[model samples]
Target: MAGYRPAVLVGRWGEEAQLQEERVRDFMRRRERGELLIQKIKSLQESLLQKTELSVCKDGCVHFGDTVLLLNPAPAEPGPGACGSLALAVPLEDSSAYSAAPLRAPCGVSAVQGVDPVGRNTFHVLSVDGTAVDEPIRFGQKFGLGTTGGFSAQMFYLASDHKSFLRFATKSHLQQVFLTEERSYLTCWKAAFWDPQLRLEHEGFPVPANSKIIITHCHTNRSLAVPRNFWTRSYFGKEYEVVCHTYLDSHKAEEDKNCWEIVTGDPSNRDGSMCDRPDPQPGGVRKELCEEA
Candidate 1:
């Protein structure tokens, strides 16, 4: 055999080792970059905390990481933008409860169930993200408002001086309602219904056992549906000549026996003069007091 063959060097092994080393180096660099970004964000948040007056609110208007509240009488439904169907209110005062924190209300149904202001004559917390104002927002304070229907309305602050809140008026605040050229009507009457539980009767209304009558919104025009949960405890005489109607089943017709005969195909021609006054109850009938007939 000839003298030992010259040793041959294959560079494949060396190349693979270099490639693995490069990958390890790249991974370390990326991790360091992520750490730097996290630190920068932390710094920015700390800086903002020093400037915002949101830390001074003590009346529950400013809660950190909690949903605030808004009060509006509009019916709940899906709509455009951050509020969805719920309303919005700006905070006016800084109290100890809201002091030293940032506030946020997440979008979607959380905005409704978690943040919406619901109740009558109570203070409502409105969460916000920004610098707090100088004084506590209270009754008579004014806020700029915009609506989805291109309608601009004023949101007056009617809350008590004790705490931050949005006030809902039990009395009518509408000075006048200007309708279009369409025929409209406003009628008031007592609501009647049967209640197995009879809870509503305790609240108000005269209900006989096994009777299936209840207050509901009904429209004469086939194309339109009645507003949801429409009820008014206050009843007054007809001021406008707009016409609307309500229907009574055979059972309800038998309750009064004589008052149920007032229906016509066109609700406008029906005799509302015979419509009885609304019963004195806490929450009265399913009456259409303000609507376009």
Candidate 2:
């Protein structure tokens, strides 16, 4: 039987300072107050865990439990690349530890650092004395104790029902893209590359309508991508030869007219996908594009 190796990983990121300290005090106070406080904490935990979902995964990735998988290189050559699997587990969760009580949900003390639903996955919070044991929750035993403190609780997760899968396109790669903008939303990556250039050649990409493409020079960490075209101004345009324009300049709010135009060569075409549309001197800085590295 394929068995699962017990691994633990923490997901505490972007937590504030004061809140962390306060949560620590709360846990310590409860622990010192004996059974009454402990029971209260357990009740709270139960309520939350009942509302939260759990999941599990066999794939060795940076999952809630598994930190990362170590891949080994093959000797000289073989099959595709060369590989094996090494399982790694990191610290579960961290927070301000108090002398009175061990912080249970320390990682969830803040708005940003709290426990988040990783969609649908099997996740179980097992009671750890020294090793991993899968015991059912009951009265007496410290089995599946939830971190939230509802009754005696344990942490657990399950694979999400909304699983994501990958798909390959029939085309070899992507080159030129089409963008459309409307009143409420925007669009990007409407079209795929028919013929790619030297830079975009063989570069395959997911054609999510209005896919954002990051354009950058050599340095800088800013990124900018045009949204897909829809109905802008009174004019219907293909792709913005430029970006960042006010919609009020064209026509009436409900007027269905194509007021502005930005034309450029299709890069995948035997021609260059360079923007040849007239400069936006009279319109706006809708063209000279820049993005993050």
Task: List the global CA lDDT of all models.
Answer: 0.23, 0.23
Which tens-of-lDDT digit does each residue in 1-293 have in candidate 2?
A: 23533443224523555578888898787667753545644443344323333222222111122211111112222335222211111112221112223233212111111122211111233332332332222111221112322222343211001111431111211111111112111111111122223225424432111111222111111111121222122111111211221122233221111111111122243222112223545545433543321
Candidate 1 lDDT at 99 equals 28
User: Who wins the TM-score comparison?
Assistant: 1
Q: What is the lDDT of candidate 1?
A: 0.23
The residue ranges of model 1 lying beyond 4 angstroms of the native Cα positions read: 1-11, 35-134, 139-293
Give one digit per residue, the lDDT tens place, for model 1 in 163-233.
Answer: 11332111222111111211212111122333325434444322221122322211111101112122222
Q: Against the correct fold, how does model 2 do in TM-score?
A: 0.14
Q: Which ten residues in a row have the lowest lDDT in candidate 2?
A: 254-263
Instruction: Please name the candidate that would achieve the greatest lDDT relative to the true structure.
Output: 1
